[model samples]
Target: MTDQRWAGVRQRVEAAGAGPGSGEVFGAWGHKWVVEEPLTRGELAELEAQTGVRLPEEYRAFLLHVGAGGAGPAYGLFPVRRVRGRWRWEGDGADLADLSRLDQPFPDQGPPRKLLDDLLAQRPEEEDFDEIEDFDDAIEAWDERWEAVMFTPERTSGAIVISHLGCAQREWLIISGSHRGTVWSDCRVDDADLVPLLDDDAVPVRFDRWYTDWLEGAERTALSAP
Candidate 1:
């Protein structure tokens, strides 16, 4: 999509908030921008080289054509260089995905889902034997597996950090895996976490579409206001 479409959204977003220094959040959904700028072709290339993975084509275009790091959901699109800081979790600070592993295929979700479901169903409500330690061991094992898949970088290989949603939430764009170009939300606090951004049709939403939707929604809200 043309960068011009984003310009109107930026205008509306700016009008909603006094300014970046005003500390006023914009949009009904609490979106705002920070660190507004555009990335050069050379910079984009260097980022790809450093990360060892190509960004999704549209996202790459956005960085080069649209502004680099502003006018997006949450605190806005993190400057590519600044992504490393927000890439990790708040509690343990584990990197979302290792730079070296960015090119690796993301693991299949089906296997892990089955493992978790089966283990959860088999969990004992009451220990028949006197071995309480056995129950503890089983619980720990399950937790370790769950954490690895839920919060670690390795589980989400081939995805790059997109934006921070605040309060321990984040957004990611798949770049190297089978479901590449799709946007996924990492809702760390939610029970069903790491879901794809799906539209009403249930098709996975890509970077451009997800962003456009946000902009359009903000515009509609702007127009409908009293």
Candidate 2:
């Protein structure tokens, strides 16, 4: 019922994705294409629903391309890789393709914790999309002035990278992984307003990372971190 707006589109995507081993699918703009197989319609719907915000129309169009052209180096959209099993790209500095993949084996070694540090150190010869990093740093710097928590855009629909500051360190909350865009933010509101939207039995839960992962999706996840 929640997916009624995109039911026709979703049906088409689910039909196409019905294979034996599809692992993931990328959807945005108006086009839905399978990224990996073996995934189910329910799972994909959950992924779409997780973000709260819907994907942008233009973005879905690009997603229909589905890495068909290899996510070119100039468009700044082609340089995506998985982070912590989630797809992310900061697109403002250094070659990030090798750094974006999260499922690569650590084996007996260790996680590439230094990957960000390393990327920061290198100088990419291409057009600098590193401005996205500058934006992230700005978000981190400005998050200390709030109380309770604040989402970049509080309670609404459409594409937005929500930034919720609960503690000192910031968390990135992403609603959906497709649109890769950010919304604005709003100050504190009474819980009574939000409570009405909740089901009777649904316990209030915390959403630090999911509220802030827009940067991972839209390159502005840390916009509200302290």
Candidate 3:
């Protein structure tokens, strides 16, 4: 099933690449391609083994049949090899996944909004400020707990970042748990919750559906546009 779907997607992409205005479509629109050769079955297996997790079917199909990286939404897809290092947001002191935990089941429930509000409300009142050092100490303790809750992977457990969509937007592929194979967008910095990408029918879109939808649109737009 995955093979057939992927083949159709590739056909559409290749047909579009040959169409008029393809350059404009790729350059200006959401679609682009680094167009590397696909990975072999052995390579795919090695990646799963190293991560201690099974690759979701469609995503595994993507890495094996599509380009091994390069050319995807926003900044393009992340190569399997690139996932091992600290993520892009790690330097910002944001909580994020370490390579060791990528295979673990993503937490079933995300931290609730009310819980976050409560934590923020816990900030020491100004009247509680006694000595300068005491206030500083109190603040630091609060910051630690806040950061931990904010960064904990419970909400996004069993997922790995697949693309950095710029502006703190990102795409993650869930690898473990019930949501495995589903793709989600991380837009929390914008005060938005992580959202699942859905197809036209409102079904949760997996990697292949998401990728092909983008490809099909790019083709049609390029061929039809003036």
Candidate 4:
């Protein structure tokens, strides 16, 4: 079933690559529509064994059929690779994922809304300070508090950072718990909490839908380029 959904994905990606203005897509230069080689079943099994958690089925299928990672949404999907006999995803901010804790459940809620609001309210503004050095010092202190709330390892258990969207933004794939298989947008850089990526109908998008939507959109953009 998964194979059927991903059939010819490589061909489609190649076709998009050949389209006019394909390079205009954000992060196009990084992947150039090149899907990395798919992972073998044994390799996949080994990765799972090492991580101690089975990847979401759709993502597992993607790794098996479509490609381990490449030419994906944003600046391309971060590819997982074996290094020093251990499998790890390589990309900007990819290490943010605590692979050792993937078996844990992703928390249903992040820091409380009121807490986030308080933190934002406390953020320092350069214009508020007369001296630039004072502003920098104040902002540095505020940033430490902000990172403490936002960048904690527990904030994203059971998730993997999948794609980087530049400017400190990235996407996450949930691997365990109730939200398993869903793709989420991380906008913490913009002082927003991690939230589910919604579709046109405002539905939480799963891995297959997320990837396929991006592929189809890219194809349309390529074909329409004049």
- Top candidate on lDDT is 4
Model with the higher lDDT, candidate 3 or 4: 4
Q: Could you tell which candidate, 2 or 3, scores higher by TM-score?
A: 3
For model 2, what is the error of residue 77's alpha carbon versus the real structure, in angstroms, after optimal superposition? 1.6
- What number of backbone clashes does candidate 3 have, counting pairs of residues 3 or more apart or in separate chains? 2
Estimate the lDDT of model 4.
Answer: 0.92
lDDT for each residue of candidate 3 in 1-226, tens digit (9 for 90 to 100): 3476677555556666666767765433433544556778877777766667777888878777766765555555666553464222221112354556767786666678798778868976657887888888898888787767766656666787776666777777788887788888777665456778887788877887777766767777667756
Candidate 1 runs further than 4 Å off = 1-32, 82-94, 108-110, 119-145, 222-226
Instruction: Give candidate 4 misplaced runs (Cα > 4 Å).
Output: none
lDDT of 1 at 119: 54
lDDT by residue (tens digit), candidate 2, 100-188: 22122212211244632443344243245468777565544433322222222222223222222222211121223321232222222
After TM-score superposition, the amount by which residue 84's alpha carbon in candidate 2 deviates from its true location, in angstroms, is: 2.0
Residue 36, model 3: Cα distance from true site in angstroms: 1.9
Ranking by TM-score: 4, 3, 1, 2
Q: After superposition, how far is residue 15 of candidate 1 from its true place, in Å?
A: 4.5
| lDDT by residue for model 1 (1-226), tens | 4465345544555654443333433423433444355677887777777777788787877777666656666556655554553222121122465667778876557336776577557645436536878777776676676676566666778876777766667787777888888988887554356788899999999988977776555555554535
lDDT of 4 by residue, 1-226 (tens): 4488788887898889999968776689877888899999999999999999999988998999988898999889999999999999999999999999999999999988899999999999989999999999999999899999999999899999999998999999999889999999998988888999998899899999998999888988876758
